[model samples]
Target: MAYKFEVYTDKAGEFRFRFRASNGEEMFGSQGYKQKASAMSAIESIKAHAPGATIEDQTK
Candidate 1:
């Protein structure tokens, strides 16, 4: 199974996505973008590098 992004609050309490490992027991990249679109873009970028990697982006 691929990883998925989960919601987590930042130091400023902003909503963002975080990557969990395939085992679902490890944390990877946690990205906080200005807009959901940016976050999605980030996910796309990541996907380009890792097609099967778990990726998630904000869509608000």
Candidate 2:
């Protein structure tokens, strides 16, 4: 796969998520969550909403 989501415990022992490319580069990372389920939910939400999201070029 070219991309994937990873969930892991941080140094602070909190659950977090990161989206990585096949080459192992991180594309994005999520805020720490108190529960694993919350992190999973955040991933699902991104998958569900990202398809219709628009790109805004604010750097112009």
TM-score of each: 0.53, 0.87
Give the clashing pairs for model 1. none
| Candidate 1 TM-score versus the reference | 0.53
Among these predicted structures, which one has the highest TM-score?
2
Tens-digit lDDT string for candidate 1 (2-58): 877665557775557778888886576655776666767777777687757665777
Tens-digit lDDT track of model 2 for 1-60: 689999999999889999999999999999999999999999999999999999999999
User: Distance (Å) between predicted and true CA of 41, model 2?
Assistant: 0.2
The lDDT of each candidate is 0.69, 0.96
Candidate 2: which stretches are off by over 4 Å? none
- Shift in Å, residue 11, candidate 1: 6.0
